[model samples]
Target: MSAHTQIMATVAPSARFDPDLGVIMPPSNGMPRSVFGRPVAPLAKWRRRYAACLVVLDFVAAVAASRTVVALFQDADAGFWDQRVLGDTVSAFVLVANIGVPLLWLVILAGAGAYDRRALGRGTEELNRVVRANIAMAAAVSFLALGFKKDVSRATVAAIIVGLLVYTVFVRIVARVALRRIRRVNQRASQKVLLVGRLADALAVHEVVTRNAGAGLRPVAIHLPQYPRSGERVNAPVPVYVGWDLVPLVQQLRADTIAVCGPASLESYELRKLAWQLEGTGIDLVVVPQVTDVTGPRIHVRPIEGLPLLNVEEPTISGLSLLAKSLIDRIAALFGLIVLSPVLVGIALAIKFTDPGPVMFRQSRIGHQGKAFKVWKFRTMYTDAEQRLEALRAHNESDGLLFKMRNDPRVTPIGRHLRALSLDELPQLINVLMGQMSLVGPRPLPTEDDDYRGDVRRRLLVRPGITGLWQISGRSDLTWEDAVRLDLHYVDNWSLVYDLGILWHTVRVVLDRRGAY
Candidate 1:
């Protein structure tokens, strides 16, 4: 053991000395030894303001949907107005509904936790809740209409429901986009975090925070459990400190959150004691486990007796979901081919005339289950591209089994524009229809790089893709390790919704052209 461990062991002979949570607990008095005023509360006023704005937007959407449907579908000349609904004329009933529906929508939204601060501006949970609430509202209206034997127009009700769902979802998406942009510019709406753990783990969490600016965690300082040595260099970007007293440090730093990353030494009881210290101080405690890349949907918390067990479901690799995915891929690919036939032909003609080469380039690529398939693409390189590969190897800008050059001599002039816009990938729809590729999955590797072993082989569990997490994330700019990590993550967490999200993001990435060659 090092000097620090020896000192800790000698200081507390019987007490549990957790390496991550090395702070010595106070006596039963529950008072901090050193009082540095009080821990500052995070800037949560924006969450309240944001939630209030959403409420207003949702109400407006409900009102517009109902009123528009009523005006368009309701026949003013029809004798329906003469009929009474709950002791009011049909026209009066319409007015009541215009007010009641929006209120009901708000209530449902609240019950579904759509206005929750935790869900706002993060993940798909808020949108999922909104969808659920709208669905509940539709069911409730249908039930009330059927039960009361009211002559409510089914067509009008359906239209209002559909309109409300679409409009409200669109509004929330726009709000999220705007909020992300604002957060990137101004971090006042973000969480002030005091990172705690070993240096490596803390740095990892910090990297994640920096990468995902919208997550709203700004690390102010890091608290290491070890004593600081004089002249010892710490490579962290944030200020680093060592001590048993954390509350005072948090207060001094004005950090409202303590993120414990990969805290291996702390028992559950000891972690609970740490939570006690933050009680009534409004300090958020976040524990980041060692598990990486597992998304929220796959993790479930099961409380049995007093132990809260985390159950991680197996990844969806096969079964009905895969079958549905396959069917959708083929159907969409066929539709795309038909709709984009003219553009495809134009591109083919362009390649034939400008590049003086074949319109299509077919290469042997490793696909699902290590199967080799001919992946097709619009020819974007000279006919002697393969012959020129040896000469350009010295100028390669990528690492480990991938060759990437920002300006390759083998690429035709027209090829550069096609690649920048990702137009060359359009022909891969044929591969999708042929069951050799997916509309969204890990991008297939050329046969030369097919040294599948260990974790690298996992990428082949699903069919290769026309576009994937790698394509939208950074493409050629990403290191080989990062590319593999992303591909493996997509393979382990494959879902229909995820695929759709990737496809949607692909459009933005293509337009941005950040990492494309």
Candidate 2:
């Protein structure tokens, strides 16, 4: 074992665990002599401490971004940064700013819990926290200036706010990516979890944890309370220790967490007992709620009269926010079409001249609430392509419900380049203006997919998007189950910040041209 994993050997004598209680009884001091019976890795605690380093990095990024923005416009012809603050020259103003700005921003981030380990590596929540903190910092500074009668360039402050916010988010994103990569490299960094539940629940939870490598949960073993001590065969690949001897199993396997998935073999009282036993054992106890695919914002845990009551708010794509979304879509789509008018005309000409077919293909797609719409796209396939689809069925390469071929013979030579660059999907900006689609949403399904009668139909709750979680995830390459899971996750967890995050990822995915037809 690595020296880092040998700390357990220096601890006190081990306590014999009661098999029925699943934990060693606390000694006179009311604490177990040694919670970790074996060499438990220090990585779980160390990861939290790693956040301290990010605080320094964030401060540096804030200062750099503030200085760069000020320097850019300080000498501009517009004279934007010519104002003085309280008889102070621009130098003194900058000096005060250099010290004050980073400190306030760091304080805001800290207060928002952005630097917390639980928030790190979580994309939407972390980004939302940072963005909200930045906005709040800007508003407070603006108010302070007005109230104190501080003369300063409003434009300079605005530019600094925008620049610092973007730069800080970029720096944190880089940090999160680096931390994830580092954690993956060190096996000890991953959470070695002991799953205690029914066989079915164990299998399901294992699948979720295994598939989501970024979740950082590694199932070391499974213990089904429903099974006997002799043990029954577990459907999962993990070893099934078939008793409630959680303390011994946790210690022997060096597990840091006991993740209980829903109420299965264990009742509420049994769960309470298990929590009580693991209290002084130092093993983290997490109960995975039965509500799956819900976003963090909607899942509120309220402590009500000593019982934790979970409040799952119903997700709504309506109200003023929905109106704001529609307005944003219309405004952005209009601006994009105007700016890219030349490119659109060029694509139209290219398609018409080379393919000798219509520039746009309108297909019947199921939209919000089973509403049908003719979604527009720059026709990448030849006029006779649909007629020939049956012939190429055997060549379909998509692992999902959608039919896709890497090199479809129906595509024109020019069409391949357009599809590869995602230029073909540009025409859907018009759909955005028409209110038939949003800038981001669940991708509209073809009418043929209507046969899917599962909760998959819930996707129709919101207007279909030109690009969405599936498009950003893997598109045609994703398994049917994965594609459906992502779409449903989007449906269940849609938020303004979540939508922006998806839109951001969609850009990267499109630029990479992955999983294209």
Candidate 3:
């Protein structure tokens, strides 16, 4: 055999081979051992210290902002400067309360995962979460103040809240920008990652790591299963190693991290055994879950004796949660109807002037519990659009039971603009107020024969949403499987936070005019 073929044969043994530790190892080829020519100790220590410092800074900022508010109002009233109100006793109490409240707020923020590096500099999601957490803290404090009959004024409380929000947002933005700059400066000093997975998953992971180099993951080697020979090296900058070679290769590369992407058709026992073998190797092992977009809060790990059992709870949408959602939806819909009445009237007039049809189109759609409800939307299609659907059925691009066309001929001129901007769906706010739908949930489907089946029909368990996961993703551009996956993910991880996130993304997607049919 040729030298390359002989090397492959020796590495491709069916049974695992035990390595001799006394065997002389190959010499290093003068490649630099340390990334960026610096030791890992100092960089890791700096990152941890930086994170702790941010927490401390946030706590201090919160207290300082609260104190500023209190001091500002103290000078405004002579009575506010009374001995009991502004004396040392009250000052100490206020100090303790301010510090304790922000610390508690930070705990809640941590629980909500606001401090994750991945979410930093992403968008307003993290900021909104911080605001919501502070709001919750404020509400709790307000109740406590009322119960204790504390003489705290409403204006003082409001000022503290406003100040905390402003200060926290400013700190978060500045911290994130500074961290991004630091990561850029230390780009090559990041963690060396060894990716272990099937070939396809490894490729996908490489793409993600390459796209976000500042995230500090540098994939130096890919460990592919079964294939004993190093496969044709793709254009990606990483080296590929195969089979049991990973054990020695990881040692050779001195990688600090190993990310195990989903296994390819491997038995669970084998996968677990592989994981066990990698333990105590001075490398952090991260397992990437198969489920996507299901937030961390939805997943629970329980240790049963020796086995780790994963528990995924079904999304809750009943009792007090249902009541809270209903109340918010009704209040929001009422205010939206009042505020947008003029715009609604103008759109109606424009539609009437442009087309000789009714301003609104009410269609029977499947609602919660498979009940039929008439969902209202501004007429965005010709009056005979429903009749014309059959003729365009051959051009349908959506998967499963949904019918969608990118450029249908039946849409009115005004309707096209309305659909593009999602203005046509504003009438569904009435549906929300009328209790036929929710502000966030799976999108309502027409009760046509092809729309649902079996477990997929569980989407009707809660009120349908006007703008849901499907809307923010790609609307009509999403395949049937993609649409179902997103809806199911929502069902598994539903929360008020998720609802607000979808609502926020909806605005961006609408403005971008993505996936509108």
TM-score winner: 1
Candidate 3: where is the Cα deviation over 4 Å? Answer: 1-74, 78-158, 166-195, 200-222, 228-258, 263-285, 290-295, 449-451
Candidate 2, after superposition: displacement of residue 262 in Å? 2.1
Per-residue lDDT tens digits for candidate 3, residues 16-79, read 3212211112223433233223333222344455667668877877877767775777665433
**What ordering of candidates by lDDT runs from best to worst?**
1, 2, 3
Cα distance off (Å), candidate 3, residue 295:
4.2
lDDT of each: 0.79, 0.75, 0.70
The worst-scoring run of ten residues by lDDT in candidate 3 lies at 17-26
Error of 2 at 238 (Å): 3.9
- Per-residue alpha-carbon lDDT of candidate 1 for residues 1-517, written as tens digits (9 for 90 to 100): 6433453444334324334533322223444454335544544677778888999999888888877776776553332221333454665667655778889899999998999777887767788899999889889888877897767666667787898898899899888877777777887667788888877888888987886566677897677766545555565676555554677667655667888878563567767887887777777778887666887678888999988887888897899999999999999999999999999999999888886768999989999889898989999999999998998899999986778999888889899999999999999999999999999999888854449878999998999999999998778888999899999999888898889888977897899787888
Ten-residue region with minimum lDDT total, candidate 1: 76-85
Model 3 global lDDT (CA atoms, 0 to 1): 0.70
Residue-level lDDT tens digits of model 2 in 1-517: 4221232232113423234423222223444334345344343665566577778888888888777876777665443344332245766666655777888889888898887666676667788888889888889778877897765566777887887788888888887667666656674456789888876787788987776455577887677675343433234475555533566557666778888877675789877776776766567788878886786688998998998998999887789878888898899999999999999999999989987868999998888788888898999888999899999999987655678788789999989999888899899999999999998988877755466587878888888888888888777778777888888888887777777888877886788798887
**CA shift of 279, model 1, Å:** 4.4
Give model 3's TM-score versus the native structure. Answer: 0.67
Model 1 ranges off by over 4 Å? 1-43, 76-91, 146-149, 185-188, 228-232, 244-248, 251-256, 279-282, 448-450
